[model samples]
Target: MTQYEVTETSDVKGENCPMPVVKTKQTIDQLAEDDVLEVLATDSGSVSDIAGWADTTEGVELVDQEGDGDVYKHYVRKTE
Candidate 1:
């Protein structure tokens, strides 16, 4: 696993599907350039959803992702 110094954390643990991606995008919007946001989600589909969102979204990077059974952690960085 890669190490990340998260600037903020967004908890959407109980959310599913588009909620995770939606919340992540919302949180990322609030972050400054180069800031990292750690998104905590319980939805298994978030792995792909978050990745795809980051890929298509400009100025945002999917830094890393970690999964431990029920919890999914996504690190997103804002780059201007």
Candidate 2:
């Protein structure tokens, strides 16, 4: 069986674009393979930024996503 763990979570509500992305990257770097990270951000751009980052970057997998009101939640898994 495969085990997934929540390694980190960031609530970047009211924050800007790069901040959320930057923080997400920092958290992802600390995670081991298959570890999950849930990031909450209010920036609308975060959806694309984080998704794009995961798709473009190596060793990162975007697992899930949810958005409501001004908050966007992104679940990412580290693969490398």
Candidate 3:
């Protein structure tokens, strides 16, 4: 995966499933095309939720994803 510079970051740690995806969507919206948004979440469900959201969303791309300790790091890129 290409390493992307995070133009925006949203930390939804301790939040539930929907909050991670919801906050990611909001943060992604604040980014411009091709900009990367890094989301930090502790909810295990967020791994799938954010990935699914990026899959279903038209302009968001799930560029990278990994787990660090209890934190799930999701890298989403805003695309045209």
Candidate 4:
């Protein structure tokens, strides 16, 4: 498995729909380039929403993702 030294974390566990993605974009914007942001979310749809959002967003990279039970954790590296 890949290990990341997360510099920041956003716990949007209970948020649904655009909340997770919104928080992720907001959080990632605050991070410096190359810094890792870890996101904890309970909404399963975030798995795809975040990924897709990151895919189209600039200055953000989806480094890793994991799903455990009802929780989804994602790692994003700021590129800009």
TM-score between model 3 and native: 0.95
* Predicted structure 2: lDDT: 0.87
Q: Write the per-residue lDDT of candidate 2 for residues 8-72, one digit (tens) a residue.
A: 88787888978988999998898788889999999989999999999999999888887987789
Residue 74 error, candidate 1, Å: 0.2
| Total clashing pairs for each candidate | 0, 0, 0, 0
TM-score, every prediction? 0.93, 0.88, 0.95, 0.94
Q: Kindly report which residue stretches of model 3 are placed more than 4 angstroms away from their true locations once superposed.
A: none
Better of 1 and 3 by TM-score: 3
Off by over 4 Å in 2: 1-5
- Give the clashing residue pairs of candidate 1, or none: none
Question: Which pairs of residues clash in candidate 3, taking residues 3 or more apart in a chain or in different chains?
Answer: none
lDDT of 4 by residue, 1-80 (tens): 65669999999988999999999888888889989999999999999999999899989889999998999999999988
Clashing pairs in 2: none
Report lDDT per candidate: 0.92, 0.87, 0.90, 0.92
Error of 4 at 73 (Å): 0.3
Model 1: worst 10 consecutive residues (lDDT sum):
1-10
lDDT of 3 at 60: 85
